[model samples]
Target: MASKPPDILLQGIDALRRVSRHMFRYRASIIAFFAVLLLIYGLYLRPPSDFPAGKTLSIPRGATLAEAARLLEEGHVVRSAHAIKIATYLFGGGTNIDAGDYRFPSPINALRIAYAITVGNFGRSFIRVTVPEGATVREIGALFALGTFTAFDYDAFLAAAKAREGFLFPDTYLFASAVTSDEVITTMQKNFLQKIGQLEPLIQSSGHSLADIVIMASLLEKEARSNETRRTIAGILWRRLEIDMPLQVDAVFGYIRGADTYSPSLEDLKIKSPYNTYLYPGLPPGPIGNPGLAAIEAAATPIASPYLYYLTDTHGIMHYSLTYEEHLKNKRKYLP
Candidate 1:
């Protein structure tokens, strides 16, 4: 009592009391506002929790972002479905997310994952298959039957490629596991067209139809191993055609039987088939196998030679003779 309280002190006390009262009156609202801010920050910008790597996530075709989020949650790829949806909605390039099997080999952020899906990054892994040169359509179908691609149907592939026998180019190819038969056929055919385009001018001026060149090339593929040998054989075969002589190649027997044979007997040659070049004059009805670019080129530009007969021996050496007697002598020496 004694000393009167300072006016300044009284004023300071009044201000502090008023401020405390205001805080108490809206305490719940203030708490809620901070909570909402924290949630928003976590949903939009927080790094996702680390998960064990090597997980595969599959999103079906035409899946919405919400559905994808649920799938991710089920796979344990992401922690919260709601958070994924919200984050994707805000940062995803677009609403459309590409649907396919995706393998997460390492830890990745949610934002990056969303971006990858939106941009059609299905985490592409290729099944590499090698189709050897001169492979037949049936052989190629068998390869597809044993391929890693789960959706590759051997019967469907056979049906699709039956009519495309010599036109299906043989080469190593990489395709997704879910690739369709039609897609495989189309790709091989397109590759054939593109590769043949390089020899268009030569084919045009060679005075032989494209089909004829292909037929000759296919024979060379089976007959010879090197480009020079192919060219020489091409000349001998072409010379035979000019004189109305039969090609008499053993490779046609393999084609007719749908099996490979090193030596065809006289009885095998007696079988009546249009592909039997031994009986028929000139080229066969069609190609026997898919020939590579080198063979095709050799057929288009054969090196002229005086020799009329040729054969490969046990040591892989080619013998050429101009006379039938000489040919028979070399054959007896090398073959027997």
Candidate 2:
């Protein structure tokens, strides 16, 4: 007689068969679930790698992150297509990446690349340029060319900045290597507008035209070094204009000559240019150079004084005189 199978063994076999039947019935669903998991793993969790040497990718303007990812993968700059998009959407600050030409020289991670493009780290070199106060357009052009700040034509910059003199705020600026002259002007002009907007109330209430105030400020920039001196000279200059006296400021000669000299000879005064303050009364046609906020403020709000004439001596001390003879005496005594 064969030994009877244990009851426990039979129960276990029956349970196993039931489980197998259910699995067979849902085989397609099980396969689909695992396939989805594999797809997600490949697209997101995969590590990034460097493309073959010399490979480059071009992302067109207005392209979506998904499209950018596709192009990057096609160029072999990335290992996954949807990974970069997801990374940028999740981790990146969602800044609209600036549209421009980009260069990829070596391997960079997806997150890093995303951030770089998002913030416009174009993988090219950059330069920091500080346009000092009172820098003429010609001087600014030379700075850009000599410093290799960008591939800008000096003549072109001068032509563009000519109309924007005194409107371009002097400040330190960072620029990419491939910036154009027009782009530079736009940046500086925008900065000027933004900065001057802060003084809008004062500018409007000063009772002086914008052009006149700017002209006065330009003179103040070359006239004095300190805020106190700037205000004092501003008063004297405005008074001269009020009384129909020629400004007789030597700074105007520097503008005419395109030189930075502040001390003009008697012959310079004879130059027939309208910018010659000694020859023409009232403000010049336009600003001589970009002036700083302090000078602008001084020009807008000149301190009233009883004195009529002022001069900076050899020792840089300012001397004030109430009469023409006194002014002449001070000039001879201190200027010598």
Q: How close is candidate 1 to the true structure, as a TM-score?
A: 0.71
Residue lDDT tens for model 2, 1-336:
999999999999999999999888799788999999777756654445545433334578997677777877787766777677766767654636555656655766666667766787677666888999988888888888874644578889998889988888889999866667887899988998888887778889888987788889998999899998899899889899889998988888888988877568888889999999888998898999999888898898888898888888988999999999999999889876
Candidate 1 residue lDDT tens string, 1-336: 599899999999999999989888789788999999778756643445755365456799988888898888777677677767766777644467788877666767666677667776766567888888788888888887775666678899888787787888989999876666787899999999999999999999888999999989989999999999999999999999999988889988888999855579989888789888877787887888888989999999999999999999999999999989999999999996
Give each model's whole-structure lDDT: 0.83, 0.81
Angstrom error at residue 23, model 1: 11
Error of 1 at 48 (Å): 21
Q: What is the lDDT of candidate 2?
A: 0.81
